[model samples]
Target: MPPINVIRNALVAGSAERRPAVLWALASLALSMLLSSLGTSIANVGLPTLAQAFSASFQEVQWVVLAYLLAITTLIVGVGRIGDIIGRRRLLLAGIVLFSVASLLCGVASTLGQLIAARAAQGCGAAIMIALSMALVGEAVPQARTGSAMGLLGTMSAIGTALGPSLGGVLIAGFGWRAIFLVNVPLGLLTFLLARRHLPVDRRGPQTERAGFDTLGMLLLALTLAAYALAMTMARSHFGPLNIALLLAAAIGAGLFVRVEVRATAPLIDLAIFRDPGLRAGLAMSALVATVIMTTLVVGPFYLARALGLDAPFVGLAMSAGPLAAALSGVPAGRSVDRFGAPRMTIVGLIGVAAGSCMLSVLPTRLGISGYLAPMIVITASYALFQTANNSAVMTATRPAQRGVNSGMLGLARNLGLITGASVLGAVFALAAATPDIATAPPEAIARGMRITFAVAALLAAIALTIAVASRAVATRPVRDEFSVGK
Candidate 1:
C-alpha cells in the first residue's frame, strides 16, 4: 500500500479518488443535520399537542425541547473526542442508529417524562453525528472544495431549520404530533444505509494506536453546560435564594472545566486551537453572528404574532422568508469563499445582515408583511454567508488528527453564542416593555426599544466583519499550518 504521507498529500491536493467519497460524506452529514435541526424546530409547533397529551403546562412541556438541546451541547465535545479516538465513520453510524431508535421512542412516548428522556437520547446521538460530519468532509475532500461543500451542507441545515416549524404545524394540524417523530423513520433509515455503505474508512493506519479518551474533562464540561443552561432557563422566572446559589455554583463549575482543559494531556477540547489567528478570529466572528442571528429570530416571532396581530398561519408564512434566504445563499457564498477566499465574502455578508437588522428595527408600527419579508431575506442571506465562511476558516486552520475535537469545540462555541443571543435579546425586549411609562408610551416608543436590540445585533455583526477582514489579510500570505492545508 502507498504510504500515509501519500494519502495525506492526495487529500490536500484534491485527488480524484477522494473527491467522490467527499461528496458522499457531505451528503450524509447534511442529511443528519437536517434531521436534528428539524426535530428541534418542528417540535416547537407541536408543543401544544404534546402538552395536552401529557397533561402538562407550557413551561413543563418545554423540557421536551430543552432536554434535547442541553444534552447535545453537553456531550458534543466529548463524543467528538470519541470520534477522534475511535473512527469517525464508526461513531457516525452508531449515532445514526441511536438517533433512529430515540426518534421511535419519542413517537410512542406515553408521557412527558418519557418524551423528554427520549429527546435527551436523541440529542446524544445528534452530538455524535454533528461533531463527526464536518470532520468526515474535511478528511475525505480536498482543501480547495471544502468551503463550497460545507456551504451546501450549511444550506441543507438552514432549510431543515426553516421548514421544521411549518412542517410541524401542518402535521399537527392534520395527522397529529406523532407524524413529526414518525417522519424521521424513513429519513433515518435511508441515512443509515447510505452512511454504512458510502462513508469511507478512517485514514489512520491499523498500527496507529488511538489516544486515551478524556473522561474527567468530559464529565466536568457536561456538568458545567448543564448548570449554565439551568441558570438561563430560570433567569426569566422568579427563583428562590437556593436556586440562585445553584446557578452560581454552576458558573464556578464551568470555570473549573476551562482550567482542566488548559492543563489536560489529551483534552476533550483542544484549547490550543484558540491561538491560531485565523481560527480565533473566525470563531469569535461566528459566535457574534450567531448571537445576532438567534436574537433576531427570537424577537421576530413575538413582533409578528403578538404586536402585529398576525394569525398563526400567516405568521409562520411570513417568518419563513429568513430561513429560505439563508438556505439559498449558503452554496453560492461557499463557492465564492473558495474562489476568492474567506474574509471578503464574510464581511460582505455581515454588512448585509447589519443592514437587514437596521431595516427591521425601523419597521413602522403599522408595517405590512412586505415590510418584514424584505429585511428578513437580507438578514437571513447575510447570516448564510457568515456561517459558510466562518466554518471554512475554522476547519482550514486545524490539522486532520484533531479535526473532530476542534469541530466539537467550534460547534459548542457557536451554540453558546446562540443561547446568549436569545437570552440577552429577550432581556432587552422585556426591559424596554417594562418601563414605568410603557403603558402610556406611543407604539413607536415600543418599536424604538426593539430597535435598540437590533442595533446591538448590528454592532455585533460589524465587529465580526472587522475580525473577518483581518483574518482574510492573514490568510493571503501563503503561510499554511504544517498539520493543516499545505502538505
Candidate 2:
C-alpha cells in the first residue's frame, strides 16, 4: 500500500492543471517507449563484442535479443490485465522503476547469463509501459486531439528505433556497450518524477479484497512462448532431438493455455474477443504485418552489411531510412484514418507494403547506397500507413471495457510476428550461408536469398490485405467519437 502522503499527493495532483498531466504523461510514456525501441537495436551493435567477450557462439548470444522479445510478448496480455486489476499509474510507476534498475544492472552485468536475465527483467518493465501508456493517454486527452497525440507517440517510437543503432554504436565506441543500458537512467528518473506529479488517479471501483491472479495461466503462457522462441532460435544451427522435443512441448503448453483461458473464472486472456470479426481481422493483420516488419528488419541489415559490404554504422543509417519514413508518415496517416474509414487506409497501406516488398525483392545486387535507401522509404511509408489504420481499427471495434485486453492481444500479435520473422528469416539466411559453393558463389546469390525472404513477407502482407478486404463484407461501424484515439 502507498503511504498516506503519497495518496494525499495524488488526490491534490489529480485536481491540478490538465496541461501538466499531459506533459507528465507524454514525457514518461514517450521515453519509456523510446527505451523499449532502443533495446531492440542497441544489442545488434555489440554482437561482435559480446561474442569476443564471452567466447560464445553467435547463436547463443542471439538469445540476448530473443529472450527480451519472448518475455515481453508472453507477458503483455497478463500484465495489461494486471494493470486493470491494480491501477495503470501504479503499474506504470513500478514498471519504470524496475526497468531503470534492470538497465543499471544490465550495464554492470559480468556474465552472459546475468545479461540475459537482466534483459528479461528490462522486457518486463517495457511491457508495463507499453500496456498502460495507450490507455493512460486515451483517458487524459480529449477525442479531437487523440489522433494527433497518438500519432506523435507513434512518431517518437519510430525515432527511437531509428536512433538505437546509431546511439548504441556511438556509446559502444566511446564507453563500451554498457553505456547503451546506462543511458536510460537519467531519462527514466525524469519520466518517473513527471508522471507521478501529473498522471490522473481514477479509481474505477472499490479494490477487491481477495482478487485472484491467473498465475498458473501466466506461467504456462510464458513457458510456451519461451519454448517456441528457443526452438526457432536453435533451428538455424542444429535441429537436434532436444529442440524437436522443446517444440512439441511448446505446442502442448499452448493448447493447455487455450483450455485454461476457456475455463478460467477470470481468464488472463479474454478469448471472447476472438469471436468479434473486426478484432479477428485486426489481430490477424497485426500478426501478419508484424512478421513482415520483423523479417525485413532482420534481413535488411544483414543484406546491407554482409552481402553489400557496407560499414556497420552506415548499415544502421541505411536501415534508419525505413523508420524515418514511417515516422514522417505516421501523423498524416493517423489524420487520414480519422477523416476516412480504415478500409481505404488499410487497403492502400497493405498494397503499398506488398508493393514495396516486391520492389525490394527484385533490386539488383550491384546497386549502391541509393538503391538500398529507395526500398526502405517505400517499406517505412507502408508501415506507417498500416500501423495507423490497424491501431484505429482495433480500438474502434473494441468496447471501452475490453480495450485493454484488445490492445494487449494486438501487442501479442505483433510480437508473435517478430518471433516468426526472426526465426524464418534466420532460416533463410542459414540456408544461404550453407550453400556448398560459398567461396565461388556469386555475390548475387546472397541477394537472391534475401529476395526469397522478401517475397515471403510480401505474400504475408498480401494475405493480410485480403483479410482486411474480406472484413468489409460484414461492414464495420464507422467510429464517431474521436476522443478515444488510443482506446
Candidate 3:
C-alpha cells in the first residue's frame, strides 16, 4: 500500500500517490475522532445503569463521566506537546492500545472505583487520539483541502455525539452496561490496525527530543486546568466554599504557569504564540462559540419536557436534532470553506449561529416545540460551519513544528467553554426562572429560563463574531485565497 500520509514523503522520497490511499488514512483518523467522542457520550447513558449495578449513589457514579473529562481536559495539551517532541505516530499508537485495554478494564471492573480509574485511563488515550489526530491533518492532506479534512473529522465527532445515547441505550437494554464499554474493544482494534498501516512515518530524529523538555511547565498547566475544570463542574449551579477555593487555586496556578513558561528555555506552550492576531482570535472565538453551542445541550431538555410538555422519548428525539443537523452540515460546510476561503466563511458561520441564538431567545413558547427545535437546528448546523472554518484557519496558518500544540490549544478552548457553559449557563437558567429549585419550577418559569439562557448564548456568539471581525480588520496582510488572516 502506498503511504496515505505523504505531505513530507512526497518531498523526501519523491513518491507518487493515489487519492484512495489518502481516503484510507483519513478513515483511520475519522474513526479515532468518532471513538473518542463516543467514549464521552456513551458513558453518560450508562450512568444510571452503572449506579444500580455498583450499588452507588448518583454522585458517585458521576465520576465515571467526570474522570474521563478531567483526564482529557488536563492532559490533552500536554500529550500534544509530547507528540511534537517525541513522535505523533508512536504516541498515537500507544494511546490507541492504552485506550483499548482501559476499555476492557472498565467493562470487567467489579467495583465502582476500579471502573472510574479505568475510565480515567481511557480518557488519557482519548486525549492523545484527539490531539494528534487533528495535528496530523496537515500531513495527511493537501493544504488547500485542510478545511474539507477538518470538516470530515468534525462530522465524525458529531455523528458520535448524536449516536451515543441512543446506541448506548440499545446496548444496555440488550446486553447490559458492560456492553457499552466492551463495544469499543473491537472498534479500537480496527482503528489501531488502520492507523498503523496508513499513518505518516515520523521523520524527526531523537537529537533534540530530550533537550529542553519542559516537564515542570507541563505539570503546572495540567494542574491549573484540572483545578479550573473541577471548580466549574464540582459545584454545578451552586457556588460553595469548595468551588471558591478551587477557583482561587486555579487562578493562582494559571499565574504561576505563565511565569514558568516565560522563563523556560522550552515551554510546553510558547507564551508568544498568542500574539498572532488570527490565531488569538481563532482560539477565543472557538471558546465563545462552544459556550453558546453548549447552552443548547444544557437548556434544551428542560425546555422540551417542562415548557413544551414533551414525553421522555420525544424529549430525546428533539434533543438529538441539533447534533444530527451538525453531522449533516459538516462536509458541506468544509467545502464552503475550501471554496470561499476560511476567513470569509468563518464570519458567515458566526453570523448564522448568532442569528439562530437571537431567534431562540425571542421565541414564544406558544409556537411550542417547532419554535425551539428550528433555532437549535440552525445554531448547530452553523456551529459546524464555524468550527470547520476556524480549525482550518488556525491549523493552516500554524507552522508544521507547532501544529500539535496549536491543535491542542484549540481543543482546550472548546473543552473549557463547554465546562463553563454547563456550569454558568445552567445557573443563568435557574436565576432567570426565579427559583432555587428548578425541578419544581412551573412551565411558564421554565419557558422564561429557556429564553434568558438563549439570550445569553446569543450575546456570547455576538462576542465571538466581534472578535472574528476585529481580527480580520487588523490583519497584518492582505486577504488571501486560503485560511490565512494573520501569521
Best of the candidates, lDDT: 3
> Which is the winner by TM-score between candidate 1 and candidate 3?
3
Candidate 3 weakest ten by summed lDDT: 6-15
In the range 342-435, model 1's lDDT, one tens digit per residue, is 6677788888988888887776354656777788888898888877877777788777777888788778877878877777676776676565
Model 2 C-alpha lDDT per residue in residues 215-317, reported as the tens digit of each score: 8888998889788877876765567897899899999999999999888877777688677788889889988988888877777866787678778768766
**Pairs in clash, predicted candidate 3:** none
Better of 2 and 3 by TM-score: 3
User: What's the lDDT of the predicted structure labeled candidate 3?
Assistant: 0.88
lDDT ranking, high to low: 3, 1, 2
Q: Which candidate achieves the best TM-score against the true structure? A: 3
Instruction: List residue ranges in candidate 2 displaced over 4 A.
Output: 1-20, 54-57, 206-211, 306-309, 365-368, 429-441, 476-487
For residues 1-487, write the lDDT of model 3, one tens digit per residue: 1223322222222125646566767778888999999999999999999989999999999999999999999999988888888888888989999999999999999999999999999999999999999999888777777887888888889988999999999999999999999999999999999889988888685565434668999999999999999999987747999999999999999999999999998899988888898999999999999889888888888888887878999999999999999988887788888889898899999999999998998774756778888888989999999999999999999887788888889999999999999999988998999977777778989989988888999999999999999988877345563447444
RMSD of 1: 6.0
